[model samples]
Target chain A: QQPVQSPQAVILREGEDAVINCSSSKALYSVHWYRQKHGEAPVFLMILLKGGEQKGHDKISASFNEKKQQSSLYLTASQLSYSGTYFCGTEPGDYKLSFGAGTTVTVRA
Target chain B: NAGVTQTPKFRILKIGQSMTLQCAQDMNHNYMYWYRQDPGMGLKLIYYSVGAGITDKGEVPNGYNVSRSTTEDFPLRLELAAPSQTSVYFCASRGTGGSGEYYEQYFGPGTRLTVT
Candidate 1:
Protein backbone atom coordinates (compact mmCIF):
# COMPACT_ATOMS: atom_id res chain seq x y z
CA GLN A 1 0.00 0.00 0.00
CA GLN A 2 1.09 3.61 -0.54
CA PRO A 3 2.41 5.34 2.54
CA VAL A 4 0.90 8.61 3.83
CA GLN A 5 2.97 11.73 4.41
CA SER A 6 2.10 14.48 6.82
CA PRO A 7 2.33 18.28 6.48
CA GLN A 8 2.05 18.16 2.72
CA ALA A 9 4.18 21.29 2.53
CA VAL A 10 6.90 22.90 4.63
CA ILE A 11 8.34 26.39 4.59
CA LEU A 12 11.44 27.25 6.56
CA ARG A 13 14.14 29.89 6.68
CA GLU A 14 17.77 29.03 6.33
CA GLY A 15 19.22 27.28 9.43
CA GLU A 16 15.77 26.24 10.57
CA ASP A 17 14.73 22.61 11.07
CA ALA A 18 11.86 20.75 9.48
CA VAL A 19 10.51 17.25 9.82
CA ILE A 20 8.48 15.20 7.36
CA ASN A 21 6.78 12.04 8.43
CA CYS A 22 5.70 8.98 6.43
CA SER A 23 3.57 6.22 7.83
CA SER A 24 2.10 3.06 6.39
CA SER A 25 -0.70 0.83 7.59
CA LYS A 26 1.15 -2.36 6.76
CA ALA A 27 4.58 -3.44 7.89
CA LEU A 28 7.44 -2.01 5.88
CA TYR A 29 10.59 -3.84 4.93
CA SER A 30 12.49 -0.74 3.94
CA VAL A 31 11.99 2.98 3.39
CA HIS A 32 13.68 4.95 0.64
CA TRP A 33 13.98 8.74 0.66
CA TYR A 34 14.37 10.93 -2.44
CA ARG A 35 14.47 14.60 -3.35
CA GLN A 36 13.19 16.04 -6.63
CA LYS A 37 13.69 19.53 -7.91
CA HIS A 38 11.39 21.18 -10.37
CA GLY A 39 11.36 19.42 -13.75
CA GLU A 40 14.05 16.98 -12.71
CA ALA A 41 14.21 13.34 -11.81
CA PRO A 42 14.08 12.30 -8.17
CA VAL A 43 17.50 11.73 -6.63
CA PHE A 44 18.15 9.09 -4.02
CA LEU A 45 18.90 10.42 -0.57
CA MET A 46 19.15 7.35 1.65
CA ILE A 47 17.59 4.03 2.43
CA LEU A 48 16.62 2.95 5.94
CA LEU A 49 16.34 -0.79 6.39
CA LYS A 50 13.96 -2.62 8.72
CA GLY A 51 16.29 -2.41 11.69
CA GLY A 52 15.04 1.09 12.66
CA GLU A 53 18.39 2.51 11.78
CA GLN A 54 18.77 6.30 11.51
CA LYS A 55 21.01 7.30 8.62
CA GLY A 56 22.40 10.73 7.82
CA HIS A 57 24.27 12.54 5.10
CA ASP A 58 25.41 16.11 5.41
CA LYS A 59 22.62 17.99 7.19
CA ILE A 60 19.88 15.58 6.09
CA SER A 61 18.91 12.42 7.91
CA ALA A 62 16.14 9.87 8.18
CA SER A 63 14.84 7.28 10.65
CA PHE A 64 12.70 4.22 10.14
CA ASN A 65 10.56 2.75 12.90
CA GLU A 66 9.97 -0.88 12.03
CA LYS A 67 7.44 -1.44 14.76
CA LYS A 68 5.38 1.56 13.75
CA GLN A 69 5.82 1.10 10.01
CA GLN A 70 6.81 4.73 9.75
CA SER A 71 9.74 6.83 8.66
CA SER A 72 10.76 10.44 9.19
CA LEU A 73 13.06 12.69 7.19
CA TYR A 74 14.82 15.46 9.13
CA LEU A 75 16.12 18.58 7.45
CA THR A 76 18.57 20.13 9.86
CA ALA A 77 19.56 23.76 9.44
CA SER A 78 17.78 23.89 6.14
CA GLN A 79 19.48 25.59 3.25
CA LEU A 80 18.36 27.02 -0.07
CA SER A 81 19.66 23.96 -1.85
CA TYR A 82 17.17 21.91 0.13
CA SER A 83 14.20 23.40 -1.68
CA GLY A 84 12.54 20.48 -3.39
CA THR A 85 9.86 17.87 -3.01
CA TYR A 86 10.68 15.04 -0.61
CA PHE A 87 9.30 11.58 -1.25
CA CYS A 88 9.25 8.50 0.95
CA GLY A 89 8.88 5.13 -0.72
CA THR A 90 7.91 2.14 1.37
CA GLU A 91 8.53 -1.45 0.46
CA PRO A 92 6.86 -4.39 2.03
CA GLY A 93 8.27 -7.90 2.07
CA ASP A 94 8.33 -7.62 -1.71
CA TYR A 95 11.07 -5.75 -3.42
CA LYS A 96 8.66 -3.50 -5.29
CA LEU A 97 7.94 -0.18 -3.61
CA SER A 98 4.93 2.08 -3.18
CA PHE A 99 5.71 5.75 -2.78
CA GLY A 100 3.92 8.26 -0.63
CA ALA A 101 2.66 11.53 -2.06
CA GLY A 102 5.60 13.89 -1.83
CA THR A 103 6.04 16.63 0.77
CA THR A 104 7.06 19.89 -0.83
CA VAL A 105 9.80 21.65 1.18
CA THR A 106 10.77 25.22 0.43
CA VAL A 107 13.83 26.57 2.24
CA ARG A 108 14.40 30.28 1.84
CA ALA A 109 17.56 32.20 2.52
CA ASN B 1 29.22 6.70 -17.28
CA ALA B 2 25.64 7.62 -17.94
CA GLY B 3 24.05 6.28 -14.77
CA VAL B 4 20.65 5.86 -16.42
CA THR B 5 19.26 7.11 -19.76
CA GLN B 6 15.83 7.22 -21.38
CA THR B 7 14.90 7.81 -24.98
CA PRO B 8 12.35 10.15 -26.62
CA LYS B 9 12.27 12.56 -23.70
CA PHE B 10 8.72 13.44 -24.64
CA ARG B 11 6.04 12.04 -26.93
CA ILE B 12 2.39 12.35 -27.86
CA LEU B 13 0.12 9.52 -28.94
CA LYS B 14 -3.38 9.15 -30.31
CA ILE B 15 -5.98 6.91 -28.88
CA GLY B 16 -5.40 3.22 -29.59
CA GLN B 17 -1.77 3.79 -30.49
CA SER B 18 1.21 1.88 -29.14
CA MET B 19 4.77 2.77 -28.19
CA THR B 20 7.67 1.71 -26.04
CA LEU B 21 9.61 3.66 -23.40
CA GLN B 22 13.22 2.54 -23.29
CA CYS B 23 15.42 2.47 -20.17
CA ALA B 24 19.04 1.42 -19.76
CA GLN B 25 21.63 1.49 -17.03
CA ASP B 26 25.37 1.20 -17.42
CA MET B 27 25.88 0.39 -13.75
CA ASN B 28 24.97 -3.27 -14.40
CA HIS B 29 22.20 -3.09 -11.88
CA ASN B 30 20.15 -6.28 -11.54
CA TYR B 31 16.83 -4.62 -10.80
CA MET B 32 14.80 -2.23 -12.99
CA TYR B 33 11.45 -0.56 -12.59
CA TRP B 34 8.94 1.64 -14.42
CA TYR B 35 6.84 4.22 -12.61
CA ARG B 36 4.34 6.86 -13.71
CA GLN B 37 3.66 10.12 -11.92
CA ASP B 38 0.73 12.37 -12.47
CA PRO B 39 1.11 16.11 -11.98
CA GLY B 40 1.42 17.00 -8.29
CA MET B 41 1.35 13.33 -7.32
CA GLY B 42 3.74 10.62 -6.27
CA LEU B 43 5.00 7.90 -8.57
CA LYS B 44 3.12 4.65 -8.93
CA LEU B 45 4.94 1.51 -9.93
CA ILE B 46 3.76 0.06 -13.21
CA TYR B 47 6.13 -2.87 -13.59
CA TYR B 48 9.54 -4.18 -12.56
CA SER B 49 12.12 -6.87 -13.32
CA VAL B 50 14.50 -8.59 -10.96
CA GLY B 51 16.66 -9.94 -13.76
CA ALA B 52 16.60 -11.05 -17.37
CA GLY B 53 13.47 -13.01 -18.22
CA ILE B 54 11.87 -12.25 -14.85
CA THR B 55 9.15 -9.60 -14.90
CA ASP B 56 6.40 -8.86 -12.40
CA LYS B 57 3.39 -6.57 -12.06
CA GLY B 58 3.34 -3.72 -9.58
CA GLU B 59 0.45 -1.88 -8.01
CA VAL B 60 -0.52 0.01 -11.19
CA PRO B 61 0.40 -2.40 -13.99
CA ASN B 62 -2.79 -2.15 -15.96
CA GLY B 63 -2.50 -1.12 -19.65
CA TYR B 64 1.24 -1.66 -19.58
CA ASN B 65 3.65 -4.43 -20.57
CA VAL B 66 7.35 -4.81 -19.93
CA SER B 67 10.26 -6.97 -21.14
CA ARG B 68 13.72 -7.63 -19.76
CA SER B 69 15.73 -9.64 -22.25
CA THR B 70 19.00 -8.20 -20.96
CA THR B 71 20.15 -6.92 -17.61
CA GLU B 72 21.11 -3.50 -18.95
CA ASP B 73 17.78 -2.77 -20.62
CA PHE B 74 14.17 -2.71 -19.51
CA PRO B 75 11.42 -1.36 -21.76
CA LEU B 76 7.80 -0.56 -21.02
CA ARG B 77 5.21 -0.89 -23.77
CA LEU B 78 1.86 0.78 -23.86
CA GLU B 79 -0.81 -0.61 -26.15
CA LEU B 80 -4.12 1.06 -27.01
CA ALA B 81 -3.28 4.23 -25.22
CA ALA B 82 -5.92 6.21 -23.39
CA PRO B 83 -6.16 9.67 -21.97
CA SER B 84 -5.59 8.39 -18.47
CA GLN B 85 -2.17 7.20 -19.55
CA THR B 86 -0.87 10.74 -19.90
CA SER B 87 1.83 11.25 -17.29
CA VAL B 88 5.56 11.42 -16.70
CA TYR B 89 7.17 8.00 -16.70
CA PHE B 90 10.41 7.27 -14.88
CA CYS B 91 12.77 4.31 -15.18
CA ALA B 92 15.02 3.43 -12.26
CA SER B 93 17.52 0.73 -11.35
CA ARG B 94 19.61 -0.15 -8.33
CA GLY B 95 22.46 -2.48 -7.51
CA THR B 96 21.56 -4.53 -4.48
CA GLY B 97 23.83 -6.54 -2.22
CA GLY B 98 24.10 -8.02 1.25
CA SER B 99 20.63 -8.68 2.71
CA GLY B 100 19.06 -6.91 -0.33
CA GLU B 101 17.80 -4.02 1.81
CA TYR B 102 20.12 -1.34 0.46
CA TYR B 103 18.17 -0.54 -2.70
CA GLU B 104 19.04 3.08 -3.30
CA GLN B 105 17.83 3.61 -6.86
CA TYR B 106 19.21 5.69 -9.71
CA PHE B 107 16.52 7.32 -11.86
CA GLY B 108 16.57 8.47 -15.45
CA PRO B 109 15.44 11.89 -16.57
CA GLY B 110 11.99 10.53 -17.44
CA THR B 111 9.69 10.58 -20.50
CA ARG B 112 6.53 12.65 -20.61
CA LEU B 113 3.73 10.97 -22.56
CA THR B 114 0.38 12.38 -23.55
CA VAL B 115 -2.51 10.47 -25.07
CA THR B 116 -5.43 12.15 -26.77
Candidate 2:
Protein backbone atom coordinates (compact mmCIF):
# COMPACT_ATOMS: atom_id res chain seq x y z
CA GLN A 1 0.00 0.00 0.00
CA GLN A 2 1.09 3.58 -0.60
CA PRO A 3 2.34 5.52 2.40
CA VAL A 4 0.58 8.65 3.65
CA GLN A 5 2.34 12.01 3.86
CA SER A 6 1.20 14.96 5.88
CA PRO A 7 1.27 18.68 5.11
CA GLN A 8 0.31 18.62 1.46
CA ALA A 9 2.12 21.93 1.06
CA VAL A 10 4.35 24.26 3.02
CA ILE A 11 5.86 27.69 2.45
CA LEU A 12 8.99 28.90 4.20
CA ARG A 13 11.28 31.87 4.19
CA GLU A 14 15.02 31.51 3.86
CA GLY A 15 16.62 29.92 6.94
CA GLU A 16 13.34 28.57 8.17
CA ASP A 17 12.79 25.00 9.24
CA ALA A 18 10.02 22.55 8.50
CA VAL A 19 9.14 18.91 8.97
CA ILE A 20 7.30 16.49 6.68
CA ASN A 21 6.02 13.22 7.98
CA CYS A 22 5.22 9.90 6.28
CA SER A 23 3.29 7.04 7.78
CA SER A 24 2.91 3.55 6.43
CA SER A 25 0.09 1.17 7.17
CA LYS A 26 2.41 -1.83 7.23
CA ALA A 27 5.73 -2.72 8.75
CA LEU A 28 8.66 -1.33 6.81
CA TYR A 29 12.21 -2.55 6.50
CA SER A 30 13.58 0.72 5.26
CA VAL A 31 12.55 4.26 4.38
CA HIS A 32 13.95 6.36 1.57
CA TRP A 33 13.68 10.10 1.14
CA TYR A 34 13.86 12.03 -2.13
CA ARG A 35 13.55 15.56 -3.38
CA GLN A 36 12.14 16.56 -6.77
CA LYS A 37 12.51 19.88 -8.47
CA HIS A 38 10.12 21.15 -11.12
CA GLY A 39 10.24 19.10 -14.32
CA GLU A 40 13.08 17.00 -12.91
CA ALA A 41 13.70 13.57 -11.56
CA PRO A 42 13.60 12.80 -7.85
CA VAL A 43 17.00 12.96 -6.16
CA PHE A 44 17.93 10.60 -3.41
CA LEU A 45 18.32 12.36 -0.09
CA MET A 46 18.86 9.66 2.49
CA ILE A 47 17.79 6.23 3.62
CA LEU A 48 17.03 4.96 7.09
CA LEU A 49 16.95 1.28 7.84
CA LYS A 50 14.86 -0.27 10.61
CA GLY A 51 15.95 0.00 14.27
CA GLY A 52 14.60 3.48 14.73
CA GLU A 53 17.57 5.09 13.08
CA GLN A 54 18.20 8.63 11.94
CA LYS A 55 20.19 9.88 8.95
CA GLY A 56 21.22 13.28 7.77
CA HIS A 57 22.28 14.88 4.51
CA ASP A 58 23.77 18.33 4.73
CA LYS A 59 21.06 20.53 6.21
CA ILE A 60 18.42 17.89 5.55
CA SER A 61 17.83 14.90 7.76
CA ALA A 62 15.36 12.11 8.46
CA SER A 63 14.30 9.75 11.21
CA PHE A 64 12.61 6.39 10.86
CA ASN A 65 10.64 4.72 13.63
CA GLU A 66 10.01 1.19 12.48
CA LYS A 67 7.92 0.47 15.55
CA LYS A 68 5.43 3.06 14.43
CA GLN A 69 6.08 2.61 10.71
CA GLN A 70 6.68 6.31 10.39
CA SER A 71 9.43 8.56 9.05
CA SER A 72 10.01 12.27 9.18
CA LEU A 73 12.06 14.56 6.94
CA TYR A 74 13.59 17.67 8.42
CA LEU A 75 14.63 20.67 6.37
CA THR A 76 16.82 22.95 8.45
CA ALA A 77 17.68 26.53 7.56
CA SER A 78 15.91 26.10 4.29
CA GLN A 79 17.50 27.48 1.22
CA LEU A 80 15.84 28.67 -1.97
CA SER A 81 17.17 25.54 -3.63
CA TYR A 82 15.16 23.48 -1.18
CA SER A 83 11.93 24.46 -2.87
CA GLY A 84 10.42 21.34 -4.39
CA THR A 85 8.43 18.22 -3.58
CA TYR A 86 9.54 15.66 -0.99
CA PHE A 87 8.61 12.00 -1.19
CA CYS A 88 9.13 9.15 1.22
CA GLY A 89 9.33 5.56 -0.01
CA THR A 90 8.58 2.61 2.20
CA GLU A 91 10.06 -0.82 1.56
CA PRO A 92 8.34 -3.75 3.18
CA GLY A 93 11.21 -6.28 2.86
CA ASP A 94 10.11 -7.09 -0.71
CA TYR A 95 12.71 -4.86 -2.32
CA LYS A 96 9.92 -2.83 -3.89
CA LEU A 97 9.16 0.66 -2.64
CA SER A 98 5.74 2.22 -2.15
CA PHE A 99 5.87 6.00 -2.31
CA GLY A 100 3.83 8.57 -0.43
CA ALA A 101 1.69 11.21 -2.13
CA GLY A 102 4.36 13.83 -1.47
CA THR A 103 4.82 17.14 0.33
CA THR A 104 5.34 20.35 -1.63
CA VAL A 105 7.84 22.72 0.00
CA THR A 106 8.39 26.23 -1.22
CA VAL A 107 11.28 28.27 0.12
CA ARG A 108 11.25 31.95 -0.69
CA ALA A 109 14.09 34.43 -0.60
CA ASN B 1 28.33 7.49 -17.58
CA ALA B 2 24.65 8.04 -18.06
CA GLY B 3 22.95 6.74 -14.95
CA VAL B 4 19.56 6.38 -16.54
CA THR B 5 18.02 7.64 -19.80
CA GLN B 6 14.46 7.69 -21.07
CA THR B 7 13.21 8.25 -24.59
CA PRO B 8 10.40 10.46 -25.93
CA LYS B 9 10.47 13.24 -23.37
CA PHE B 10 6.93 14.29 -24.31
CA ARG B 11 4.18 12.50 -26.21
CA ILE B 12 0.48 12.87 -26.91
CA LEU B 13 -1.58 9.82 -27.60
CA LYS B 14 -5.20 9.61 -28.61
CA ILE B 15 -7.50 7.34 -26.70
CA GLY B 16 -7.14 3.66 -27.69
CA GLN B 17 -3.68 4.25 -29.13
CA SER B 18 -0.63 2.41 -27.89
CA MET B 19 2.98 3.38 -27.30
CA THR B 20 6.21 2.31 -25.64
CA LEU B 21 8.52 4.23 -23.32
CA GLN B 22 12.13 3.18 -23.36
CA CYS B 23 14.47 3.19 -20.35
CA ALA B 24 18.17 2.40 -20.19
CA GLN B 25 20.81 2.56 -17.51
CA ASP B 26 24.58 2.54 -17.77
CA MET B 27 25.09 1.90 -14.08
CA ASN B 28 24.70 -1.83 -14.73
CA HIS B 29 22.23 -2.13 -11.89
CA ASN B 30 20.23 -5.31 -11.40
CA TYR B 31 16.99 -3.67 -10.27
CA MET B 32 14.88 -1.41 -12.48
CA TYR B 33 11.51 0.17 -11.90
CA TRP B 34 8.75 2.05 -13.71
CA TYR B 35 6.53 4.63 -12.05
CA ARG B 36 3.91 7.15 -13.11
CA GLN B 37 3.28 10.51 -11.47
CA ASP B 38 0.13 12.48 -12.06
CA PRO B 39 0.42 16.21 -11.79
CA GLY B 40 0.82 17.33 -8.17
CA MET B 41 0.82 13.70 -7.03
CA GLY B 42 3.49 11.31 -5.89
CA LEU B 43 4.76 8.44 -8.00
CA LYS B 44 2.93 5.15 -8.32
CA LEU B 45 4.93 2.06 -9.13
CA ILE B 46 3.67 0.27 -12.21
CA TYR B 47 6.27 -2.47 -12.59
CA TYR B 48 9.73 -3.51 -11.57
CA SER B 49 12.47 -5.95 -12.60
CA VAL B 50 14.97 -7.67 -10.37
CA GLY B 51 17.24 -8.65 -13.21
CA ALA B 52 17.23 -9.76 -16.80
CA GLY B 53 14.19 -11.97 -17.47
CA ILE B 54 12.73 -11.31 -14.02
CA THR B 55 9.82 -8.90 -13.63
CA ASP B 56 6.92 -8.27 -11.30
CA LYS B 57 3.85 -6.07 -10.97
CA GLY B 58 3.81 -3.03 -8.73
CA GLU B 59 1.02 -1.10 -7.05
CA VAL B 60 -0.61 0.22 -10.25
CA PRO B 61 0.13 -2.32 -12.93
CA ASN B 62 -3.04 -2.42 -14.95
CA GLY B 63 -3.06 -1.00 -18.50
CA TYR B 64 0.70 -1.38 -18.68
CA ASN B 65 3.34 -3.98 -19.41
CA VAL B 66 7.10 -4.21 -19.15
CA SER B 67 10.05 -6.25 -20.39
CA ARG B 68 13.56 -6.70 -19.06
CA SER B 69 15.27 -8.53 -21.85
CA THR B 70 18.67 -7.16 -20.89
CA THR B 71 20.26 -5.89 -17.71
CA GLU B 72 20.60 -2.39 -19.12
CA ASP B 73 17.18 -1.75 -20.57
CA PHE B 74 13.61 -1.95 -19.30
CA PRO B 75 10.78 -0.63 -21.42
CA LEU B 76 7.19 0.07 -20.46
CA ARG B 77 4.30 -0.53 -22.86
CA LEU B 78 0.95 1.20 -22.69
CA GLU B 79 -2.03 -0.16 -24.61
CA LEU B 80 -5.33 1.52 -25.33
CA ALA B 81 -4.30 4.73 -23.73
CA ALA B 82 -6.89 6.62 -21.77
CA PRO B 83 -7.08 10.13 -20.38
CA SER B 84 -6.69 8.66 -16.92
CA GLN B 85 -3.28 7.36 -17.95
CA THR B 86 -1.93 10.77 -18.74
CA SER B 87 1.06 11.33 -16.48
CA VAL B 88 4.83 11.60 -16.32
CA TYR B 89 6.68 8.30 -16.22
CA PHE B 90 10.01 7.75 -14.53
CA CYS B 91 12.46 4.85 -14.72
CA ALA B 92 14.85 3.99 -11.90
CA SER B 93 17.69 1.53 -11.34
CA ARG B 94 19.58 0.20 -8.35
CA GLY B 95 22.43 -2.19 -7.76
CA THR B 96 21.92 -5.66 -6.39
CA GLY B 97 23.89 -6.26 -3.17
CA GLY B 98 27.08 -4.29 -3.27
CA SER B 99 27.55 -0.52 -3.46
CA GLY B 100 24.28 1.32 -3.33
CA GLU B 101 22.24 -1.82 -3.72
CA TYR B 102 18.62 -0.87 -3.06
CA TYR B 103 19.63 1.86 -0.67
CA GLU B 104 19.44 4.37 -3.50
CA GLN B 105 17.82 4.37 -6.91
CA TYR B 106 18.96 6.50 -9.80
CA PHE B 107 16.07 7.97 -11.77
CA GLY B 108 15.64 8.75 -15.47
CA PRO B 109 14.75 12.09 -16.94
CA GLY B 110 11.12 10.94 -17.27
CA THR B 111 8.64 10.79 -20.16
CA ARG B 112 5.49 12.90 -20.09
CA LEU B 113 2.51 11.36 -21.84
CA THR B 114 -0.87 12.93 -22.40
CA VAL B 115 -3.83 10.90 -23.58
CA THR B 116 -6.72 12.95 -24.78
lDDT agreement of model 2 with the native: 0.93
- Provide fnat values for all models in the order shown: 0.91, 0.91
Error at B3, model 1, angstroms: 1.3
Listing candidates in order, what is each one's chain A TM-score?
0.98, 0.98
Clash-forming residue pairs, model 1: none
Quickly count the clashes in candidate 1: 0
Model 2: per-residue Cα lDDT over B16-48, one tens digit each: 999999999998898999999999999999999
| Tens-digit per-residue lDDT, A1-109, candidate 2 | 8999999999999999999999999999899999999999999999898889898888999999888999999999999999999999999877788999999999999
Q: Which ten residues in a row have the lowest lDDT in candidate 1 chain A?
A: A90-99
Candidate 1 docking quality: incorrect, acceptable, medium or high:
high
What does candidate 2 score in Cα RMSD to the true structure? 1.5
Candidate 2 TM-score, true structure as reference: 0.96
Error of 1 at A72 (Å): 0.8
State the lDDT of candidate 1 residue by residue for A46-73, as single tens digits: 9898899999999999999999999999
